[model samples]
Target: MRWFFYFAYICTMETKTSKIFGLRSVIEAINSGETISKVFLQKDLTGAISNELNGLIAQHNISRSYVPIEKLNKLSKNNNHQGVVAEISPIEFADLDAIISTSVEKDKAPLFLLLDGVSDVRNFGAIIRTAECAGVDAIVISKHGSAPVNADAIKTSAGAAFKIPICKVDHIKDALFQFQAAEIQTVAATEKTDNLIYTIDLKIPTAIIMGSEERGVNPSVLKMVNAKAKLPLLGEIESLNVSVACGAFLYEATRQRL
Candidate 1:
């Protein structure tokens, strides 16, 4: 089944391909290190095959949507979609450790961006775009409570997601400890503090934490941070959007680094 899928994929001229028809074929694509952007499951799907597909999607952190059979059929162009379709990517993820090691080896202060519970794909993509523009060493995100790196995110990032190193951690606090142990100061961006972003000296090795829109930073992660700062707001609005805040923080760091 996998061979058939691969043969079909090889014969196609399309730069990107979507898998359809069988459950195992989609699973094989994921297991074989194929870049799955998204997966669509028929709304009424159940039984062994459905269970297995669900498990694989969770394991690989693949974004999925429950849709009607008609939707899947439409997506598969009236082909034998078999209640599933998976979108493949044209690029791959970067090595997290290599990004950090290279930054230190070059005598560069490690400028890292940590996103805590940011679920919006557009926001995540926008942040990556800014991080790449500001020359961030890497972006760290928790395995859960973050946006999946799907095709929409990649497109919105203008391919910066492929260019940037994105580290997925199980526990954000543990990752913060690792960065601190490596001599990187962990900075959290919050409206709770009075310290202006410009006042913080980002010339040193730094890791900036940007939180979610509704909840802000998780308190457990907040406790692990070395310092907390805020972007001064003169307008009636209290805070900035997460992505905009991230860009402001990163570019401020860029200024100090220069």
Candidate 2:
């Protein structure tokens, strides 16, 4: 098999993430510096090796949960899972500082896409695909309250997740500060702004921010950005889907940069 992923233990949704079963395999993965998102362990598991795994998981600050053995059995297809399985992120995240450093060395201006609380994996993936297609230099997402770079996100991205550099920031506001320091203008996509997207100068280095599905950009975030712009809404619909709006924003930048 090339690859397969599942989330049998989740009660909220049937979203799938790449997984590797067995305790020793997980330990080896951690030792080899694999991007492990979370680890599921059988309840009441103990002993030296399990203890070692626990220590390693803690040391790396990886999220973990203790579930029933039956849950582990389902996750592992009844195979010997050694009471543990780990979720692995398919794409390795890039460093924001590194991206900024190298982007300045290039001849062309850098284009970055930042997601503010976009939690839907499908939406996140679609935005990623659009950013990659628009020649975005990098994508920045907050570490918490964001969609996982799991199987579904990668699938929805049509493999663009691997092609583009996705950087995880401790907070979206923190990233805005860094972009400002680099002299990259930050633009937020929101309806609150009176300025239209067409008026903004995107020919220079810029980072575009897209907000969550439920709400537009955070009020605090909007305050930090250098400029705020919105796409023209000709219809009665008050808002557009975050992904669709993101495509429009990125392409406008593309057109201006061209």
Candidate 3:
């Protein structure tokens, strides 16, 4: 099944970047270790080239989508895309296991941010920027319902997306389980909680789950976290934007750690 990526234009951190289009160019980029965010291939494009692309995707764990030819045309800006176009990412994604190990090696507690369903590109970017500034160890998000790491996200992040590890997992729940087994606490930031964010002992290794502004944290995820916390919102505005709320939550953890 071809997946269409309908994201707005996003500029790159560097002025000079190789524009990769067509199957051969994309295959070369993948083989040469280029940081590709995702690949868009025309739906039902099957042949030796597609087979080779699938093989490389399996070998490198690259993100891919199958979509209509029109979608591919739009992505390639009407260039001769040959049924494939690869978006190159400036920053290489970090492995979750390696991130955890590095923190352990340094004898430091890990602080990770997990987004439940933050699909807004700007919001995702802001969270990434703030997480980097707050010294977060990594930012994790499920691949299914999260925003694509496009140019707008990168630009909105002020390039902080390049500074931190953004780990895309198969499932948020499974990742939470790994953190628990590793003795890391997972905290959900939501208004439904009476417990204050300041009261949590965030100095320990922790992962903070921040959800969309509209829905807050998922109930299932809330139940699984070690603690539920909220910032006292004593104003006419019912809530803060997810990005603002995330920044607040992360900084409180920073305060506790310091």
lDDT of 1 by residue, 58-126 (tens): 997876789998888888888887789886655565555666667777777789999998999889889
Q: For residues 1-258, write the lDDT of model 3, one tens digit per residue.
A: 112221222333434343579888899989998877778888888899889998998787766778899988887889999999888866667788777777756667889999998989899999999999999999998765677777768878877887899987877897898889788999998888789999999999999999876787889888899999999989899889999999999999888878
The candidate with the higher TM-score, 2 or 3, is 3
Q: Candidate 2: which stretches are off by over 4 Å? A: 1-17, 21-28, 38-58, 61-85
Which prediction has more favorable lDDT, 2 or 3?
A: 2
Q: Model 1 compared with the native: what TM-score?
A: 0.78
The residue pairs that clash in candidate 3, if any, are: 2-66, 2-67, 3-66, 10-151
Candidates in order have lDDT scores of 0.82, 0.88, 0.84
Evaluation by lDDT, superior candidate among 1 and 3: 3
lDDT of 2 by residue, 17-91 (tens): 378988889999999999986688999999999999999998876767899999988877888999998878988
Candidate with maximal lDDT: 2
Q: TM-score for model 2? A: 0.78
Candidate 1, residue 176: how far the Cα is off, in Å: 1.4
